[model samples]
Target chain A: MRKFTILAGLLLAVSLAQAQEYAPPKGDAHNGAALFQKFGCYSCHGSWGQGTGRDGPRLNPPPAFPVVLQQLRTPRREMPPYVASIIPDQGVADIYAYLSSLPKAPDPKSIKELQ
Target chain B: MSKRIKRRQFLAGVAAAGPAISLISTTGTAAAQTAPASSIPPVPNDERSLNDMPPQTQGKSGSDFMIDVIKTLDIDYCASLPGSTFRGLQESMINYGGNRKPEFITTLHEDSAAAMCHGYAKVAHKPMACMVHGTVGLQHASMAIYNAFADRVPMIVLTGNIGNSVTRQMNVEWNHSAQDQAITVRDFTKWDDQPQSLQAFADSMVRAYDLATTVPMAPVLITADGDLQEDTIPPGMEKKLYIPKLKMRGHPTGDPALVQDAAKMLVAAENPVIYVNRYARTDNGPALLVELAELLQAPVVDSHGRMNIANRHPLNHSPRREPTFANADVILALEPVDIWGLTNYVADLIGRPDLPPRRNPNLKIIHIGSEMLLTKSNFQDSQRYAQVDLSIAGDAESTMPSLIEAVKSQITAAHKSRFAARGQKLHEMSAKFLDAARQDVAYQWEARPISTGRMVMELWDQIRNEDWMMPTESQFISDWPFRLWDMNKPWHTMGGSGAQGIGYNTPAALGAALANKQHGRVTVAMVGDGDFNMAPGVLWTATHHQIPILYLVHNNRAYHQEVMMIVRMADRRMRSNSPNLYVGTKIEGPNIDYAKIAQGYGMYAEGPISDPKDLAAAIRRGVERVKRGEPALIDIVSEGR
Candidate 1:
């Protein structure tokens, strides 16, 4: 029983480690715009980080830069991973900064079509 | 001396020289040896030529008689783009046939003709005729034919072929003639035949129709010979022509013992899931499926190949397919295209597929469908083979009643109480998903470059009250309606383009609209821009026929799916700066004016509307225009999906 308890504790520790959050480095918005276009992130997320339905999710009001970096490292769904070897850590950071700095989409209610 | 040689002199010279002299001659010998002393070839007398011709009467043309047989089949329309090979039949259809029962509906392209027939068959639940111009036309129509075949929809394709080489005219006729035109599409169609004579044509036509309409149905081809269609009936030969009666074979039902066995399994299992695709043929199908599911209190996962069940049903588990399947001890698949894919979890990641996840190892799978009834050796649309405990080769809809009865018989009072409790739990889960979907729409509801979720909600608000039919599945706004809209009615959804061809949406929607027009159902479609560009001329046909469809262009300004794929490829190679990827994929820079094109086709047009707020108003106006029995189009500048 004591051994089983220790094993359970170890298992809990492994899961906690896996769930730990990533820390992102400081990035430049201007550099991020160039990286976003250069890395073809704009192809799916759109030129303005407004996601297309068939391609990717929206990122204008960017998620935590760390999460973005993690997504690029180990992607979900159909998105391909961009490892650090392929796209340097700085490139991903720059993309996140650009997305974070991008102008927010205007209210759909303000648009003549949405009402 | 006379320029024309006398027939008597020429004949005398030929007789004296013998036929060998003319045959042995190379250049001038044939003509010179056959010529008289005047140095001119003899012309045959009109009376002599008349004697050589077959004895004939002014009886009806063979094409007219062919139309008579087509009429007996109760075909409503014969869509075609005119070709010379079928000129005789076309003339007969318009004139002698009086064009009433099977009216000749002129389509702009052969693909449009086939696609129109496909959509019509889906709504009407009956196959219609499509005529094409010999080999060239059949080639054009092949893609749509494959689409119909994949979807299990019936269509009878009639293409003109010149069977006799001797009878064919020079140049154009030679180009049009084929030993067998149906060969191009035979692998895709249920059956194909090239009839040699008028009697054969009638028999083949009827047989093709019967084969196409049967369960596990697909498009069938009958290449009508130009000779058979154009030739005048010889004296007394008209009386000999016989038209055979068409026979529609019954749909196969599962063996009673097997159905009972399946029922027992379902009854014994702790959790059972039902998956459906291409299962609903008409309103009765969905009703029967609903009844069966409610009886068993099963969770239904609709693939939306057709509207197999109401999306808003309390037991719908479409959004939770993976979880529901994972939990299921017994899974019953109804006409699913890829049972193997459904049972296995495949990661899209590079090497992650090495260790694919599967459902419970001991899970029992019972597959009921007519997928085994008819199959082609090629095209691979049959999908991968799946291991099943029991496979029933029968039509899902036809087998549902027996299965329902069997399940009902096995249920006890205690079992009923248990099932009711289980059903109540499932109902709550379904409500939760629906609420979640509604909330998801509110996300970015007011974002510019409008969100697909928001777009769908706005459109739904306008058309929810009307009897609306959307006969398309747009990639730009996929599954929005399935999650948010009420689709209980038979004509509410008409499924996707089967072959995944680009040009199917615009014409197919028009075709469904044409069918709905007679029934007074308001037909609408959200078509992708890339698909619309493939055959925008279909708009002309809609205007000309006055097909009152409200067409909305989800113009993302690119072949966005291809762009995504290209980007993924680029990312894998670590080469992000590629102009070629964008060069072919992007449809922007000078954005296509779809509304203007619609206006050119004489349709009520609006937009390139990027603003989200204007969507509802534009859709409302378009719906109003549709209500007034006029075709309309609105172009929405949408973001890529």
Candidate 2:
């Protein structure tokens, strides 16, 4: 089942890459951080897009820009549809850049509390 | 001996000693008259002289008899704040009766008093009394009373009333008095009464205890009228006032034929799954369930209304309920709080259209519980109805033994081998689920503004060896304890607040700790910031009463659940400029200092600690305080679930 999920995800990523006709504008990570909190995206996704599993999925190492935009416009599950009116194209690109900018979580072995 | 005979003997003894008491009094009077003028101290002008002394009434008041009734019922605690209407009863309990058996536990609010009873009963397995102050107090306690009623917990509520307007002293008494005080809570209570005489009060109290403790248990109220409580008992009425003997009723069991049929269904099925909620009433309850599951080699999904199964048990498939139900040939639910929500898949869509069953289309479902035995129309706690192949009306724990015996009679050698193979597969599945949960927690393990997962794991690591009781729910902490902790003891967890009330966690945890104090177990609870704010004064009550508990505030600085809902609402409306969504939902602007709040209440406390590195040491200090018989609190600035 894990293998099947990985294969399906790769195929979707390839299809989204082929379908995109234009590149998104470069985004500012600092401005994206402010926009993330302003939009209340941190409520479901954490303050850094680290999902709680109870409400939303993790977004660190975010998917391709087109896929994120598509999901926001028309959510497939319980997530509310975030149309362009609620979040413009620039806002989505900035949110993606902020998610990408987050540092990788430290190893559990390195944290004495976790051990 | 009858109380009447004892009263008569006491009166006769007083009559026999009357001459001796008169002679001593007359001698003292003569001696006072002959005393020297210089030896007697002169009275101050401000104080009244001895000649100005007035007469005072002296004898047992009606409240003395009420205290006797309470003592007869063997109630250990009475949780209440002082009120005027029951002031007579309170005085009698302390001075006349010595207040040993039913010690008064002072509380800051009536809701906390009632919720204390709610939490205490789950661990003590017996009802504790809470005194409500007439109409206003009853209204204050109504929510906690409703929570206990919905949870099917037993408790006694004694409300004071001044039924006679003539005897009311002042404006406050008039305001507090009421004609039908118990009526406010009658819909939710199992039984209520306003007893007019001491004999009547004795009989009614025994009846209330019986009704409250029976299966499908709930809170019961008996109004103690102010006038009745203060007025002296008539000279010879003591003979007629006899305490009634309490007789406990046996729990109902499933019918023999129905039990046989249910057992047959389980034995014949290729894949059977057991679902349980609020099923374990005693330690023996979990043992019976374990026996039945082993007999059938079935996977048991504990819905956690109580600690129904060991978390590390091989047959416990709580984390894999969806897949287990999908493949199940036979499903048996024991005392399920919501059968429909468990079986169906309802999405939170725009319309929330009727969803089909998530289980196999041809699956046979059986339900056994006493929930249908007692219900009311005014409250809608009875969840949505779900159609089932078999419905047996009985207490699930009481019926489990009979069902297990029937299953044992039918098992053959061929069935044994098949069951063994199924058990092996389930054991492997349980191990994999635990490993996956461990892997999931490793994410964001060292993040600042500490992850709830890391906080919970740190606390678990400290207290896992100590005999500990967690009286609060785990939903706000992302249910990390359920996934990681090995909760084999019955008191390891006492499910959620039955009515989903906000203020239940703090007082209820303290109440459970009060019960755990005698058993020498460490009590720990993780309360949400929203829940803690509802009754922060409960911390003072815990400190005053010396009820030891380790309270961790999962301080997300927001009513985070509502934040998600508001976000959903905004996106659904396609609203632009949704930045101010946290107006009503967020608890920020000035984050509450829970550590100072706990300190002000005379409890040892630490933090607003956002660093995961500091959590372990702070939690250790709190645990050490609790171990030494003191209350403690730790505030962890954490992620929203």
Candidate 3:
């Protein structure tokens, strides 16, 4: 079990290193927004790419475009795999663009309601 | 004409007139009219006139005996809608029984009545009676009955039917009458009987009560025959009839040897996780689980079946089940509703293929629960089977003390330091998880259509200090309450509808509030728009009975869960999933005015409040009204999912 944990930690580190080097191809943000809703990405991930505790993870500062595409085609955990026949590569790229376009959430300390 | 007749004289006069009328008919009409005034005989002083008078009083009825049986079982309330088939029993309940113990609570629909019993049982720890008219009424209540059965909550469903076709008068009577009335809900309920005699009715009532209250409990049905309910107790038969004493059955406990084995595994494992659902039968359940988890310093994952643990406890890792389970070498599942779903991950894809187990493949599992004891083939409430290393057939809460004792006996001094270190690490992890949740909910925190997370936090801030209970499930709103609130009490939440049925929230919440009223607890619920619309009349029931609760409608204006599923389907087909997706699923075109509906039911209400800024004030007002013993509602137009 300890060996498995160490191996998992190493894999995560490699993924993080790879994430730093990757740069996504430029896509139209307007079309990306429409595509995000079209594919129903906003159902689990909220309309603004903010996720919920019980559903999806936060996607605003999304992982690398390759990682996102890989997850869509062959997903891990409970997410259903979207084969190439369903969502093409261009659609995945648009969704990535939409996620990247979302601004960072406001600091909770600055929000009076949260306080 | 000049003299008023005496009581005896009047009786004689009527007898004389009867003979004169017959004599007139026998003779010719012209001769009879001419002779009637002169030929009528003088009234006779007859002894039979005194004997012919009708008796002024009916001493006892069969329904009065039925009430006696109900009172004997100590059922607190009978929630019902008036129907002709049960009129005899209903009248006797109010008039003869004085509506005291097993008080009559009028509901607008039979479905609401059954649901009220479902919610009442979870908190009261006993069954309440739901009386319904036969056929149509039982059909109306079938979904709620199925919900109670699936939840393993005890309830007495008394349905009225005219078993004898001869006694059925109107079209409705014949329509409602059935040869076997219990058959409608027999598929779901644990036991059902249509008693032939009053003595049999008494016996069945006691038996049903005992069966319902036993471990692995479920709803039971007793069909009261309309004729039997209305008929007089036969001559000298009241003495023959007997109300049997209610037999209290002890909950099944695990075999001592097997319990010991489970304890040893839990103690020896490096990382153990206790997964629980519907395990907390009483307030003591949480304390027992706490003792067990702290002894081993194991993380506990509550599946929100009931309030199984204090949410703020450092060992509680509900929001982090995946990582906790991933590291677990041993798992002790306590009455899990779906053990297979918890241990394995299965995606709802095109073929619905089973994935590999989420936990360690060799992880030892110990199951302690009586879920298998009461199961039927027709309704599939029994979830898919999962193989376990040790299976103990017993009530988890009842078997907990012995398991705790066994673990104590096995633990050594060496284990204590290791356990403490494990506890510290878990505490740090729990704190970090909670901090992450706080950050996640901050996105769009000030949106115009209020975020469900912000809505939950605002409500929590106002009622955190009060003795509060949220009877409704929180899944629709991303389960923000479970993530954010400090839910320490047993009744803090009542879990979800056992069958995931819609229309459960409105009535069930009121039922829980009804139970909480006696304890002076402030009750709150957040219902979905679709659910509230299914049985909004339950608000009228709450207002009439004065069941205090703050009901907030999470009005997303669509069956949001269905909308998500439809979107997934469309995406799977590679079609447009949006804009047109709202066609069938949306609850709009003219959005429902829930505030107006609540006001019509005489409940204090506010909103269609859309702004996040306005939510806190509206919540405060609703809470105040609830505290003053009035039901209140706030309809918040909010984000879907």
Candidate 4:
């Protein structure tokens, strides 16, 4: 279950990378973890930002600060456009740092196919 | 919130004069029902109704009025589960839609609801309405919708929603609401609509009906805002709305000039062969295909499917038509997924994709199929088309007749010499393909862990000549046994992987079984264990309704594709390896007891078949139980990447 959570989180992380712009200013994983939980991001994205919310996409694929800034400005499809006003740069940075801190999702083969 | 749409405006909105009833109560069910054949009763049976709850303040659209609209569309039952967002709409449905307002057959989970719609529509061959509760509902529905998309089942899905303000502010509303609702189903639906105005809703709806019913049909979505369900127009607007009927069929008249030229090759080639597929179940495709085959007295190989030509037909050639295929100077492939398969499988003898596609130096090709423009929905790139000397695009039903006409126009008894020499030689080769395929099954059954080949062949002996539906999984148990199954068309094998979603087969098979319930078709959904584990709860739906579906769980453990990739990795890296591919891929420890799981959900269950030899009997048992009108499961334990 924990492994799946990590995987789901990583999925979101990957998508987040694609959905948002890149701007990792040497993010601090510890600070990122704090902000992620504080914002209730885990409720839907699982403990590490994998999807759990009925409709939330994964959040681990860390978007660099530029991508985060971009998401705030130019939103696509259904995701609401967020601005620095709604989520500050440092805060977004912290979340990104926290997600990047988690181990990348292990490939099924690397772990051994379930027997 | 405005409970009322100003009366005069409501009057203007209503295209017709006010009905006899002046009261707009959502709770007055009995009173609002249009007692006679017309949907909601215009005159309320005030005395017989539920007077305890006050009429809904938001108001009820004339129930009979809405019923009047639904009636025109020939809608019968509405499928749904409880949700506050749709309460007003349900009320309006009963009241306005009247007799046409489908009595909602609610289920526990939204997935089952979608599957029920799948099964229902398969049998009905038309769209059935199923409404879910906004964002969360749509999310839950994603898996089933994916299956439906893969199965190519047409459904009209409605979801309850609150506007953005409500989704943002109100807790009850926000959780279920989405800013862009259609995003949930964009990958699966043919079209989706979120009309802001009722007029737009109605208009988009008519368009939706048209699009969904067209060829290559699948489900379409339309979000019904909570606000719209109960909003009443004046009185008589139902008549102005119209939904179009779905239709598509095309024909290419074989040019008489080309026919003569092609006939010279076809009738003169001693080893001419005919390849057939999905055309068998089509309108006149089967008969016309048969006529052309009989004209040449050529053997027809059901290369991709079953019974395009009846197995017992005298002119029906045997399965070992390979030599005929090989020796023929010219071969005609009709509606085959393998016309390309043949040339590609023998590519080394010809050429590769990097260069221009080259066919066998000795063989000529005539290819006939419908579409040239392909979509990613099925992962088939349009550029992969085989290089054929003559590739005709038209309905197999349409083109077959024309080709048959051409064959009749030229071939004579003297032309018997055209087919005799190669026909005898080819007959021997078919026996080889058939013998090899059969031995292949035997060889697998003799192997250690469970083999998919033995599993399907054994299962076939159990359910042959019965109504069976297999979700076409690309790598799993799909093509290996295509040699044995009586497949006449694509529908015979429910190719439920167009979207290639992993967890789609279980629910989809459940749906197809449900659709086939009354017809006494024992629907079989052969799926990977991973696929089954994803939505095993659908078993409850089958149990709930006594739907007798033979849910075969191909429990080979692990994501085989990934495992294979890892093996390839080791091979590419020049490292000697063992099948440690079973690392995280196999299911073990508290390994799932699929039989217990099925029985837990009220299905008759069997297996964990340790021996491949018993695979046939286990499948037979599951089919027998389901044939008796109860759901059943057979979990086959196999070892594969």
Q: What range of 10 consecutive residues in model 2 chain B has the weakest lDDT sum?
A: B20-29
Q: How does each model score on lDDT?
A: 0.80, 0.84, 0.84, 0.59
Instruction: Please tell me which predicted candidate would have the highest DockQ against the true structure.
Output: 2
**Residue-by-residue lDDT tens digits, candidate 4, B309-405:** 6543444454445444555567777656546666654321112223223344678887765444113354332325567787765435556666776
lDDT of 3 at B234: 73
Decoy 4 TM-score against native? 0.65
Instruction: Give the clashing pairs for model 2.
Output: B4-B239
- Expressed as tens digits, the lDDT of each residue in B462-567 for candidate 2 is 8988999999988777778888778899889988778888889888888899999998899999999999998888899889988999999999988888887887
lDDT of 3 by residue, B305-361 (tens): 888998889999988888898889999999997877767666677777787555776
Off by over 4 Å in 2: A1-26, A63-65, A106-115, B1-55
- Greater TM-score among 1 and 3 belongs to 3
TM-scores of chain B, in order = 0.90, 0.92, 0.91, 0.74
TM-score of chain A of 1: 0.74
**Which parts of model 1 are misplaced by more than 4 Å?**
A1-64, A76-78, A84-87, A98-115, B1-58, B247-249, B351-355
- Residue range B62-162, candidate 1, lDDT tens digits: 78767767866878888888998888888777766666557788888999999999998999889888999998999999999999998889998988887
DockQ ranking, high to low:
2, 3, 1, 4
Task: Please identify which of the two predictions, 1 or 2, would achieve the higher TM-score against the true structure.
Answer: 2
Query: Fraction of true contacts reproduced, model 1?
Result: 0.31
Candidate 2 Cα deviation (angstroms), residue B618: 0.8
